[model samples]
Target: MRVVSLVPSLTEAVAATAPGLLVGATAWCTHPAGLDAVRIGGTKNPDVPAITALAPDLVIANEEENREPDLTALRAAGIEVLVTEVRTLEQAFSELERVLVHACGLDRPRWLDEAGTAWWDLPAPPEASRAVVPIWRRPWMVLGRDTFAGDVLSRLGVENLYAGHADRYPRVPVDDLCAAAPDLVVLPDEPYVFTADDGPEAFPGLPSALVSGRHLTWYGPSLAEAPAVLGAALRAARP
Candidate 1:
């Protein structure tokens, strides 16, 4: 079945589950590379005409990625639309299972079970007891509260310093980050591409490291392989 994915994470899911089935996708959908398929548009503003012209059998999107108006329009157009909303690890796994079931018409893969096993088996990072994972720079946005990233950190036995905050993705002053002074600072490698060179000069004494944004931040089938990568990164950043 031909598919058009408007959400980046769903794009990754579809590609992983059924590769060549994707006929169109957004520019931001860059997982499972070599998907030179049609560029629908961005997350917020998909090229409706272009997508309509593709006439895909299914169009996948995310509640967080696409705007309501566009989703409404797509639904009005009578396109079979599947929307995914992933806020926690359980939600992520559910979304993955849903996508796999929809795309392949089968039961959820054993990968999910294996992923759970890997997560449960890993020894919690000692120094990561209190950590803050920064996903963006510029205005300094962070994964806050009960977000998927926060849940992943929690499962690894790491405490998210911002998990106490009310906002899910909060933009705070660098001074606030300095004040939190977490045991470890996790700088994700996308959105803002924070690297070790960026350092923690703002926090002075915190140990920091650059981590894979896709592994730590994305919520999809990729989660199956993320724990090990995150575990090693957290271990290396231990104070």
Candidate 2:
């Protein structure tokens, strides 16, 4: 079965499960490292004509990363597009199964099973830390309500300060976030490339836990290591 994936995590999933099945992927689909596939484009701006030209049996996309009009065009072109909505860890697993097992008609990948075990075995700290997770710096966007990263952090006892905020990813003034006075500031390396010198300086005295964006936000084989990887980073946070 030939497949084209627009979402990076889904691209990694398809590639890891059956690399030969994936004939095309987005330019940002940079996982399973050296994936040999036709570059369709970015998640928000996939090349519809280029994708259509690939003539794959299936195309995978995410509700959050992809644009609706692109999906509509693919369907209009008679291509089978499987759209996944994964806002939580559990949802990620279910969606992975749906896309890989049901949509692609392939056996469940062993890595996914291992990921379930990884998350299930995590020991949630009784006293969770309040944290403001910043995804981007310019205009300062943060993880808000109904986000996959927030849900993952919640499981690991890192409470998101804006978890109840109206927007999923809210752009706030850096000053306003500092006023929230979170126990720590969780920073991921993607979408903004926040680093020791870059993001930590924004929150003067607050502890900053720099984390892998893939493990923090992505829902793929990385799930197998997210629990342990993110857990350690969150725990080691110092004020």
lDDT of 1 by residue, 1-239 (tens): 88899877778776766677789999988887787589988988898888888888888888877888887888788788888888788888777788778554756666677876776677755544787777777788887877777888788768888887889889988878878867778888877877766746655778886678888878766777898888788778777
Best by TM-score: 2
The runs of at least 3 residues in candidate 1 whose Cα sits more than 4 Å from the true structure, single-residue gaps closed, are 103-107, 123-128
Per-residue lDDT tens digits of candidate 2, residues 1-239?
Answer: 88999999999988889899999998998898889999988999999999999998999998889999999999999999999999988899999999999998899999999999998887656588899999997789999999898899888888899999999999999999999989999999998899999999999989999999999988999999988898888778844
Error of 1 at 129 (Å): 1.8
Candidates in order have lDDT scores of 0.78, 0.91
Candidate 2: stretches off by over 4 Å: none
- Looking at candidate 1, the ten consecutive residues that score lowest on lDDT are 119-128
RMSD score of candidate 2 (Å): 0.9
Clashing pairs in 1: none
